[model samples]
Target: MMPLDNRRLLRSIVKLTEKPDVRAFELALLATLTEIVSAKTIRLCKIHESAKPPSQKVVVDVRVSDEEPLGDDASLPTLLIDDAAFLECLAKEEKVVASIGLGPGVRIVHPVKAESKMVGFLVIECEADIPRDQELVSIMLGFYKNYVSLLTHTQRDKLTGLLNGTTFDDKLLKIITAQRVGKMRASDGKGLYYLAMLDIDHFKAVNDKFGHLYGDEVLLLFGRVMVDTFRDSDLLFRVGGEEFVVVLRDVDLAQAVAILDRFRLAIERYPFPQIGKLTTSIGATIISGEDLPASIIDRADKALYYGKNNGRNQLWIYENLIAEGKLKVAKDDSSVELF
Candidate 1:
C-alpha cells in the first residue's frame, strides 16, 4: 500500500466532525479508513439487545461499505459474528489480529468505546500490516468517539434518551431513500418500512392525578420499556409529549402489527409504582414506495386517532382500517410545506 499523506489525512479527520448527521459521519469515517489503510473490507458492528420473553442475546447490527452504490442487485455482505475469533475479540475488548480464511490476508478487530461504554467493534481486512497502523487507528477512533458524543447529545431527548423530534424528519427521509434505492431490505426479500405512532393513554389524567413529576417518571419508565421491546435496528423517536414513533425496517404488516401489540401488552402489564398499571394506543401503516415522510406520518397519526377514539389501549393498522371502510385513504400531497 502506498503511504498516506499526513496533510490529506488531517483534512479527512476535520471533515468527519463536519458531517451533517451520524449516518454521514459514519460513511465519511469508512471512506477515510479505506483510504488510510488500503483495506479490502471494513465493517462496524454494533450490539443490539432485546430483553423480552425468550431472553435473546446480543444481536449484531453491521454496516458495511456505505460508500458503495445501492441498486437492484446491490447487497451488503452478511455478517456472522458468532465465529469463535469474533467472540474472543469482543470478550477481550482489545485489538485482535487473526487469519480467518485460506486467502493470504489478515483481519483486525478493534473495540470501539464511547462514553466509557463498549458500544461496538471495527473490523478491517488487509493484505499486510501497515507501519503505525494501530496508532493511526486509535487516533481515528478517538475522533469518532468525541463526534458521536456530541451527536448523541444533540439528537437525543434529554428526558427519555430516545431520538428528539427534530431528528425525526432527516432519519425518516433517509430511511425512505434507502428503501427506494434498494439499500435496505428485510430477511424475506421484501424491502418494506412500517411507521407507527404510539401515545400513552389518558396521559393528561396521570399528570393531573399524580402531578407533573410522577408523569415524568411514567415517561421515563415507558422509554425504558420501548428500548427493551423494540429491536435495536428499529428507529425510535420521542416526537411529542407522551407520544413516540417507530420505523420498522424490513418487516411486513403482520410482523409490524405483532411487534406493536407486544409493546402495548408490556406497557399494560407493567407496574408503575403508585400509578399501578397504564395502557397505550398505537396506529401503524406500511410506508409506500412513493410516500413522503409527512404523508406516512399523517396516515399513522390518523390510525392512532382511530384507536384512541374507538377505545383506549389498542393497536390499529391504517390499511386495515381503510380496507374495512372505517378510515378513508389519506391524500398523498408532498407539495404542502412542512414546518
Candidate 2:
C-alpha cells in the first residue's frame, strides 16, 4: 500500500481534536484509524484498574466497526491486567501486536496514556498492515492524550479532581435532555436519572478544630472514597467546598439509595488522619421528565439540607420528603437558576 498523504493525515488530526467529549473523541479516533489502516474492527477500551479481582482491568468503553454502529455495552470483552500480553505492553509502555483465537486478523493494542498514567487502550484488527502503522497510531494517540488532558483540566476541580461546579450544569442538562429524547431510558421501570448531593457533616467545625490544611486533607480523602464507591459511568462532581453531587443513570430509587448509603457507611468507617471519625449527610431525588438542571439540583440540595438539619450522617430522598409533607415541591420554572 502507498503512504497516506501527509496533508490528509494532518486534516484528520485536526478533525479528531474537534470532538468535545471523550465518547465523541473515541468515535472520531476509530473512524480515522479505520480509514488509515483499512481495519476490520476498532475499539476503545477504558482500563478500570480500581475494580476488584479478575475484573480489575479493561472494559470496552466504545467499539466502532466498519461493519456496524458503535456498541453501548462494555461487557463485550474484559481484558485482564494480569494477562501476559497486556502486562508486556503496560510494562514496556509501548504498543503490542498479537493474534487472538477470536478472529483471523492480527490485532494491535496501543496503550492510551494521559499524564504518564495508563487510562485506556486502543485496539485495531486488520488483515493487511499499512507502512508505518505503529508510528501513525502513536502520533494520533499523542494528540488524543494531549486533548484529553486539556479537557480534563478544564472540567475538573483543582482540589479534588472531580468535575467542577462549572461543568456540572452542562452535564446535568445533557442527562435530563437525553432522558426526554428517549436516549437514556431506564430498563427496570425506574427513573432514568438520580441526582444526589452529599455534604460533610460539621465541616466548618473540622476547619476550626483541625486547621485548614487538615480540613483540605479530609476533603481530598472523601473524594477518593467517592471515586472508589461509584461506578465509572456515574458522574461525580465536587461543585463547591465540602459538597459533592453524583448523577446516577438507569437505576431505581432502591438501588440509588443503597449505593448512597453504602458510601455514607464507608465514609463513617474510614479513619481520617488526626480526625477520629467523619460522617456525611446525603439527599437524593429522581430526575423527572419535566425537571430542569437547576430544579433537579434544588430538590437534591433540599433533601441534603434536610438530612443535615434533622440528623447528621443520614440519607434522605426528596420524593419521600414531599410525600410526608416535610418538603414542598418547587414549581418548575425554566427561567429560574437554582444554582
The best candidate by TM-score is 2
- Candidate 2: lDDT of 239? 91
Runs in model 1 deviating more than 4 A are 49-81, 128-131, 179-190, 329-339
Mind giving the per-residue lDDT tens digits that candidate 2 earns over 1-339? 446898989889889878876667778887888788667777777666443553365455565221122245654446665456566667777888888667777877788887669777787777755557767888888988888888778788988888899888877776666566664445565645788999999999999998999999999999999988987557789999899998876678888888999999999999999997999999998886577777788788888888887878999988888788787654763322222
TM-scores of all predicted structures: 0.84, 0.87
The TM-score of predicted model 1 comes to 0.84
Model 2 C-alpha lDDT versus the unseen true structure = 0.77
**Residues 149-243, candidate 1, lDDT per residue (tens digit)?**
88888889899988989898777776677657764554563546788999999999999999999999999999899999886557789998999
Give candidate 2's error at residue 110 in angstroms. 0.9
lDDT of 2 at 307: 81
Q: Report each candidate's C-alpha RMSD, comma-separated, in the order given.
A: 4.8, 4.3
The CA lDDT of each predicted structure is 0.76, 0.77
